[model samples]
Target: MIKDIPEDKRNTFAAIGLLTVCWASAEYALDFIIRCVHERYGGSQIREAPPVSFKGKPPYLREAFANHPDLAGYLPQLNEFLEEAWQIAEQRHWCIHGSIDLRADASTFPISKIIHGKEHRQDTREFTARQIELLAGRASALSVNLIFFGIQTVRLMPKEEANKLLRELLRKYSAALPEDGPF
Candidate 1:
């Protein structure tokens, strides 16, 4: 059955699948951090886990962290990750939702999205398989870094333990973590 499919379609499918897995990993990590922060500091009156979703995820994270003043120190790093993650999210959105147009040479395909919001907006971009692969790699790294960020939070550990684990994570994944990432 796979052999019957066109090469471009097959490649597109594979890329999408890889990106989805990477994105899901990052999303799950973000959710884990949010839930931990909420439960640890939300107090007995707040019994429910904080809401986490693709839409407004950055804001949701900001609000969750803000609710607990102690996490203020991590805010800058979290903001940086959120900015990068949001860019990746946009590319992922276009890949998944935009109309696909294969170039004549088939070296690259253009994805177009039309926004019918307050102001009409048209977005079209060409993507190569290599570009998609790079995006996937970034998403994967973001997931790992997010998990590290979470370990540093949760206050379950003493200050020393939290910093110790963070240092170990950074040292272990030195290449994977972005240079700008908090050490």
Candidate 2:
């Protein structure tokens, strides 16, 4: 029965399966982190498990964004970052799970040649690397936002003051540190 199916269709099915697994894993991590922060602040003294499943398109990523109301001002940037990350992850999923016919009509070009050529490859490794870097920055921003929320909810600091301190901490952490004498 499997032998009767077309190669392209088989590859497509494999890619879809891989993508589903990646999305599930990513969502689980996000859910765990959010639940930890929520529980720490709620002061219930009893821990609750993270959600078993996410609902809707890109559920896990959506839930991560949805739970952070305090970071509403940064939503535009966060959304842009997550969208790019998802695209990169999807591309990686395809590359890993789908067969690439190098011998097919679509000729394989070297990385250097593609960039130096008049019409470069539509998707270059460098472009993907940059996207990943941007995604990391956005992830850091999300982490900082979560810290702020935790502080506020736990009453460690007032909202206005916590925001101010958080910004200061972000600036300090983001800046390059000077090299002191080696230990």
Candidate 3:
């Protein structure tokens, strides 16, 4: 399908691909942070230190919450959603990246690792199929958002305005999906 796309459309496709990569990467990192937080905070009587390490300032997640202080107001629920989204993003990334090993059979990789942590433990084939489905859905959603964002950016919209639009789009899209648990 990508090969069949016209030259002009190719650039659009490429932009979408880049945005998807960015989104996936962000999702992965956020999930990692959320897992760290949960393992530190959830259930144990001892107050564990925050799992995130910092160079100068606190971790990005903390900083993000701080900068958008309202996020801290709903910390528990927000962190839960963030963790869920992160897990889906992590699985999607793994499936996409693992498929790159063209010479090896799928069985050579640990099939158990793919679906072990999910609430519903699907078989390897089902897991892979679901991941592919998610990827396709995410790509379509991201592409539409990217097109609109690009148009707004090119129109010389204020940075804050553009960021607000992007954030709202992502929030809506993420809210529409099923929660997948922390990575």
| lDDT per model vs. reference | 0.76, 0.43, 0.42
Per-residue lDDT of candidate 2, residues 9-72 (tens digit): 4544354454455554554444544464345433122224434543322343344445555434
lDDT of 3 by residue, 64-138 (tens): 443443345545544544454445455555554333322323322323233555475544422333344555566
TM-score quality measure for candidate 3:
0.32
For model 1, how does the per-residue alpha-carbon lDDT over 1-183 read when each residue is reduced to its tens digit?
Answer: 889867876787688779989999998988777666666766323435466457756876776666668887778898998998999998999998888875445868888999789989988888877788889999999998887777766643455655565667668876343443343
Error of 3 at 42 (Å): 25
Rank all candidate structures by their lDDT, best first, as comma-separated numbers: 1, 2, 3
- lDDT, candidate 1, equals 0.76
Backbone clashes in model 3: 0
Which is the winner by TM-score between candidate 1 and candidate 2? 1
Pairs in steric clash, model 1? none
Reference-based TM-score, model 2: 0.33
Worst 10 residues of 1 by lDDT: 174-183
- Model 3 misplaced stretches (Cα beyond 4 Å): 1-22, 25-59, 62-70, 99-130, 135-183
How far in Å is the alpha carbon of 149 misplaced in model 2? 13
Candidate 2 lDDT: 0.43
